[model samples]
Target: MPMRLFNIVYITILCLFSTFVIGQTLEILPPKNITTVQVFNPQKNDNTAIIRLGSNEYLLFLFDDLEAGYKRYNYKIEHRNADWSESNIFESEYVVGLNNDYVRTYKNSFNTYKKFTNYQIQFPNKDMNVKLGGNYLLKVYTTNEDQPIFTKRFAVYQGNVDVGMKSSRYINPTYKDINQRIQTVISSGSQNLTETPDGGKLFIMKNNNWNEHIADINPDFTRSNQLTYNNVEWTFEGGGEYNWFDTKNLDVPGLTTERNFRKDSVYHTVLRVDFPKYNLPYDDYGDVNGNFYIRNNRFGNEYLAASEADYSWVYFALDAFEDQNGLYEPYVVGAFNNWEISPQSKLKYNPVSKLWENEYFLKQGYYNYQYVVVNTKNKRVEPSYVSGSFWQTENLYQGLFYYRPWGGRYDILMGYGEVNTRN
Candidate 1:
């Protein structure tokens, strides 16, 4: 057999016999009772889960169980490659302490109509610590079950390299007004990166949405110790700012909320009807770029709000009669659902009202969302179909650099950086 084909077959067998095979995509697989899964850096006050290695920084993982009772939940951490596949290295090589352990922090909801038990865990604790800087996955599961309730992705970087990025209008004339391009440069300070053709990889994501990203991009130019990525294909849709509404207080309606009422002993918030922005000019009203944080305006303490905040049924209506043909399906997407399309977020057409409507049971917080369409034939998600695209739209772009020396067992996260279009 050829050398390359033999190596490929060997790797496939190794992955199959491994403890677990993380698929190509990073995703969350929560059951029906799970909601509001969030992983973020508490100190940074943002949803991005990238942290520096060997620093005091930690990533916070929070989720709520609608079952409303305490349960014995355990978590396990696994190292992954830049492509999100299981790494070839052993757990002991990547983790300094126990890789699997129990979650000791939880709280029951207080003074809320909807009953729930919130579970939280912080990483790099005494029980568990990651020694290697690379992609990692946190899997939460029942004490006795091998199947995970949900899995989340986070990254650790060594900061050994300096990564810089700049954004501008796309070079293509046809997409110049509707798309934005990013150019990246990585300076390897002291690390000796392999000079092989396939030794390094770069990934770029927009607005911290891992579901949609550009991956496996090689540097367009290489210098003494610097790599540059100026490819024209590194362009993303400059979708308009996310539509936002506040639900910090259940008793009082917030801006963009049409009404708030008590129904079935629970609060219900109806947002004003929305319209397509394809033809409308860009509106830079400022938004969190499709992120949300739990808050209860009635309380003075944030931690108190975490447990005291109530859940409500939020109603959304989009009047897109012109775009509501049988060829496309509309979905309301945001960070609440990890920006993934699910059955609950899919809007149904109401013939009587001539609108697309859907409702989500969400915790008390301010949220940003937008309407997107899926092409029926191609199963492609088009954010610009309903939200519109413009070069002036502000966006947060993140760049990650990964390196794997020749004959290395796994990839190492050497550098991480962010760039904002409005900056």
Candidate 2:
């Protein structure tokens, strides 16, 4: 097998093994009715769920359950090593106080068609705080549940170094107009830090996607207190601005919303069919940058009860032609799925309808989504197949710096920085 293909298979096998091993500690099985899941730094709108260690910082996590009833939810944190495997450490070694706490704040949806309970909690709060700087996973579960309802991966980093990242047009002539390049530099003020050529690792992500991140990146060069990494592999297709539709008001549909009608038990809404954009020029517009927010306009107030909101079967349709490659499988990707490619988001091609379609049981809110084509052979996802790539498209890129001390068992996030293509 080719070296690249071989590496992919090897990594897949390793991941399966990790699943078998880590499954004992990390049990994440969210129900299908959960929606609008978000985890990020509350202070900064563009910040990821990464915070500085020992600082008065917190990571906010929120989600909505469409069950229409009250349920006790609690959370706990687990420390992980550089490779995301559960670290062999006791809870008291990293946690300062209580390791788990109940989610005291929840509200039922009110004055809306869908009824769901909104649940939110923040980490490093009164009951608990992290002591170690490494990778961490926050697991949310209900009372007496054997498995967690969901899990969000977050990081607590020690700001030991300064990171600088920038985005520009790709230098490769063929991909110049369609792709953008990323460059990173890490600098430390302390002279004690020495370069560990093979120990340093860098990860880059577009938007807030973790599954589609660019990993296994190493620094190209290292000086006394500086590291630089720039490569052609860091170039990413400038996916077109995300297509969005607002379902804030169940009674009225907007430009992107085709129509909405009530069904047997829930409402059904169909979004306008999206055609191939490869033939058209890029159009610049403001978007959530592929992120989504839960909004229920039917509720006159910002605070809402979980039960007052209603549910809808939102249908997303894409125009497809017979000439399209059969090997490519398209999946609807957005914050709704954590931007991860999964079977739940996979699209089905209907020859009779001449369209690719996927239906989601979503809450009444504003959402952003894009169709991405997954190459079955290599398991790589490309967004240009449905949403055309262009240089003008606005994109967000984030860089994370992981440092592991000598004899250290885990990686410490030393620096982080983000840049935009349009900046």
- TM-score of every candidate: 0.92, 0.87
lDDT of 1 by residue, 1-423 (tens): 112111122122223221224454335468868888888687898899899999999988988899999998999888888978888688889898787888898999999999999988999898899888899989898864357788888999989999999999764565543478889999986765547657788888888877556777778888758899997767787889999999998888898999999988899999999999888988888899999888899875556777789999999999954554577878898888776665767899898988899998999998999998766655556777787888889999999899987778889998999999988
Q: Pick the candidate with the highest TM-score.
A: 1
- Model 1: residue 370 alpha-carbon error in angstroms: 0.8
lDDT of 2 by residue, 254-304 (tens): 679999888786788899998878778888878878876655775643335
RMSD of 1: 5.9
TM-score of 1: 0.92
lDDT of 2 at 5: 13
Residue 370's lDDT in candidate 1: 92
Each candidate's root-mean-square deviation in Å? 5.9, 3.7
lDDT of 2: 0.72
